[model samples]
Target: MKTEKRKLAIWMTMEAIEVIGLKRIVLDRDVAEAVGFFHAVIAPQVFATAERFGIHRVDVEETEDGRLPG
Candidate 1:
């Protein structure tokens, strides 16, 4: 028996009153799943950070491209 290997790309953006940043991360299939699971749980804190910064409107853009990994 043989196992197949998979790779993934995860992109995240953070916008706030004082600061804004973008990130492009790559991970294996398993790690990607773990990250996805925690993302929802951690979103509140992320938003809170923006709120603490006095940002009423926080815009975020996220993307994933497994087909184009570099």
Candidate 2:
């Protein structure tokens, strides 16, 4: 279950990156959560990819559901 969730989260994050482009835009965890996976489990992977794309300075804001702010 955890692995599936992680994979789903990674896919979701990648999709978001593809759609939004790896710019200075904030990543709302709510948008990710709506995909139905836990952010904490997938954040490291997402951030890793962002880093690979040279997105070092990320702004992880908190929403009502404690999601990463966009």
In terms of TM-score, the best-performing candidate is: 2
lDDT for each residue of candidate 1 in 1-70, tens digit (9 for 90 to 100) = 9988764333444455212111222233366644654354345565566576665633334325322112
> Candidate 1 overall Cα lDDT vs. reference?
0.44
**CA lDDT scores, all candidates in order:** 0.44, 0.51
Per-candidate alpha-carbon RMSD to the true structure: 16.0, 14.6
| Residue pairs with backbone atoms closer than 3 Å in model 1 (clashes) | none
- Number of backbone-clashing residue pairs for each candidate, in the order shown: 0, 2
lDDT of 1 at 28: 38
User: What is the Cα-based lDDT of residue 12 in candidate 2?
Assistant: 45
